[model samples]
Target: MRQKATSLFAVLLLLAAGVAPVGAVVGTGVEASAVQSNCSFPVTATDATGTEVTVEQKPENVVTLGPSEAQTMWEIGGKSQVVGLTKYASYLDGSDSRTNVSGAGRSYVNVEKVVAEDPGIVLAANIVSNETVQKLRDAGLTVYKFEKAKSLEDIYAKTTLVGELTGNCEGASETLSWMKDRISTVRSAVEGSDAPRVFVSQGAGWTAGENTFINRMVELAGGNNVAVEANVSGYGKISEEVIVAQNPEWIVQLGAFGAYPKTDAYNGTDAVKNGRVMTVSNQNVSQPAPRVVYAIVKMAEAFHPDAFAAANATTTASETTTTQPTESTTESAPETTTEGAMEGDSTETTTDAEDSTGGTPGFGVPVALAALAGAAMLARRR
Candidate 1:
């Protein structure tokens, strides 16, 4: 049992270290209206790499260097234009039909495959190295690299910019409008409610701090981030002592791989005792795309259920009276399976189980071993 625990702990650490930099979103300070007009050809804009790239015409074929970029393209109605993408983007629908441009790992780009695609434009993510971007450019390809997205505004700007680049301006506008409306609803719902103290665990001891999208999500969902409170500046490991001292009311795991470390410090927290633990899908929360609004809404519902429910009911009523309700407009609160656990593809909780080894319940030796193997493979891929 001890051996299993040790091995699991090691894997968790590896996940913690590997997870943060992959698809990490930060701000670029670029406005959505940086371009003059929508779908305008020969439009020139400076990318995150400080290079001016001009898209002379609508791209017939596009390539994405990261999952987030691919997600953005798909969201903005440019899916058919995506001719190449990395392996991590396999989760997207019909991605298998596109050529894989992944090199050795998730962040590495296969320049030769990308060149073969003969893409009209390449959308690069923050995770893509500058050297790789230059290599693509050296091969005479037009590449626009996005900086890290820090805030919701940054994400909005990126979406608009993507649409402009891909000649999907109308789609981008629609997506941004939807995102803003959802965000406004969440803010209104959580208004005047008490903000819970939230601790977001990526895995092991790593937590998101200031200048990260995860931290922004917590704040937007009307919860205070304990990592930010502890002065953790970026994605870094936090001491178990701080976690206990902060006493977060809610603990959020990033993905299926995310788990609270097996330690007295984590077990003694209010979140654990009361079972106020929730898991958000990695794709929605980690990627800086329009889908991040889903994570925000999920967190808002978890953190302030009463307020969210009231707000959601009001919105539904208004929609019913204003027009015929459509499937897209209809929304429901997330279903709770346990005291603090919710259920959905984007948000879920680990099923409760009795811990025989005095560790956290539902996270046993066997489970950890399995998670360890999976995380190791994921780490290698990322």
Candidate 2:
């Protein structure tokens, strides 16, 4: 099972590579008929397991097991097609009305409930047990799975894949272009600023390191990840000694504002003494999707106040003094569970990151929505 899961992950990596060979959506024998070559039929995509999955028809009813998948589907104009979603996916705007197939607490799917939905397509994440995916396939359901994206590039790839599956490739392309533009704006805003040494505290002990999108976002926001600099990779605990030795200038917490209040470990740190510790919404700062740019902007504002201040002042002045009008437009979790052993006999478990390799799936639409809300709050403050 583990080996099969690994193969699935490799295929997702290939999908994240942005392109793959096309194949026909085969008749898996549950209830699906043979696919015919048409606009919707004969759609082919590779799953995380390296199996080529072809949809005989464009899915009229879709079930998304990951919040990120739901959000991406919505962003790509496929919301009307979503008929089912995971319980946690309720965080999305329209998901509350969708049928909740997976149960609460655990990240595993309820195979019986899923089959009852009789969905044309089931979108899932790597955190879903391979057994569950196999069972769905056995039942003649088309299941499309993806591993959590680890970077902006991965997010684009995933978005593109969703677009292709939903027959919304144009929407996906436009979304990708919008994300790039937003990122470029942020980069230009923070250009030439000295990058701050930063620590991303997901919880009391968990911190983001290399090979994770959080680390990438921090860099894009003009800050250096202290955890990555410590040679830590993925999600891991950072020792107090390391924290003390490398006193970060900024601390970005995943939870509420008071989550990481002043403590012995932070007493002398620049972030603590200067009161620079910021609590970004976990949904936005954590999720790896288009809305991630909002978090990046928030981070940039926090990390280099001077840059934003200058930019804001310039904008304000230009708006107030010049006779110019501008047009503006705006738009737009997880598939896996992981069980980890904590300190005691009782096992501590975490879902995959919005895409979780550690505590919970950190990437999804709710995270993005929360990030957008955070951006709004920051905007109001300005």
Candidate 3:
């Protein structure tokens, strides 16, 4: 239960700026301070909405209202403290013990069940309305609402905030360090490599555009996002004609299912004829948590196999040959920047909103990443 408020700012600042492994050091000033402040109570923290919340004691029972928050809590070593979560919490392998207590989409919250749990702290995202937050506050409950994170910096800030609240600032620092290292690793691997024109599909015609984590992920992995190139911002749908017009070299579908059923739709495109279409797990890509690193690496390998040849290369020449790039190497694709998208003005059409309560059953991650994801699913069953 160590909560060092002193090093909190410094650690968070490093993470928000993005991780560079060149001269990074962990657990010196900030981490040591966190370790020294174990079990500290009456701590004050500010939420993403500029609200200051003071916790008189360590929260033994916690409730997370969103998948991203739940995943963040687990990363900061507070998973065992979570007592309740939404039905979508099932995405994490060991979430069976946590009961589903969310509303239908992202608006309503089951206030009755939330109060019954007697949680010391209740976590929520921006999608949760102000009225609902007031209801919980009126009941004398502690609630912290996180604004919708549009960038990696926002995610790091939110993660650090949770660490401060849960008295796991040390864990938070460690997790952020891990994330920075992973991101740095991927970036270095793909440096100076060609950025292939890639279409990121989340099934049902929805795709991630600017102001979204997925968009940033593509840029970090050295893949040109065709949706962003088409001026599509935020999660929106583009017509089939637009897809044909763009003619992406690679199609990286985010969910369990592919947006395009057969190659007929992409008959002449590079993704179909060249077999460069890939399916990634929704849980890894959708949740803005530590698992995002997995998504970055997955897309990097797909977009630039040659960039990762050294690490992926095996002693056997035959297996090495298999890892070679099959698709045409994109030489001069557009370089992506972290441009924020307009909120609520997106024209993209999505089958379902994946705010906090949505779930795609058939989505699956690679076996290696899946094992790491499961191990991160720390639980504290009431």
Which candidate ranks first by lDDT, i.e. highest?
1
- Give me the displacement of residue 69 in model 3, in angstroms: 1.0
Best by TM-score: 1
The segments of candidate 3 whose C-alpha lies over 4 angstroms from its true place after superposition are 1-39, 104-107, 261-263, 309-382
* lDDT for each residue of candidate 3 in 1-382, tens digit (9 for 90 to 100): 1223222321221111111101111111223223332446776766534567778888999998766678778777888999987644555546778766754322235888888888999887444555566688899899886555555665666666677677777677777766665566577668888788888765446566765666778899899998898898755666677778889899886443324534455667788889998866544554555556667778887787776655444322322111111221111110110000111111111222233221111111221122222222211110
Clashing pairs in 3: 1-39, 2-38, 80-380, 236-348, 237-348, 237-349
Model 2 residue 347 CA deviation (Å) reads 12
> Per-residue lDDT of 46-119 in model 2, one digit per residue for the tens?
67656788877677888887556776787767789898876544555677787877653333467778888888
Q: Write the per-residue lDDT of candidate 1 for residues 153-195, one digit (tens) a residue.
A: 7778888888888899877876776677678789998898999
Which wins on lDDT, candidate 1 or candidate 2?
A: 1
Which portions of model 1 miss their true places by more than 4 Å?
Answer: 1-30, 33-38, 105-107, 316-382
Better of 2 and 3 by lDDT: 2
lDDT of 3 at 67: 63
What TM-score does prediction 1 earn? 0.75
Candidate with the larger TM-score of 1 and 3: 1
Count backbone clashes in candidate 3.
6
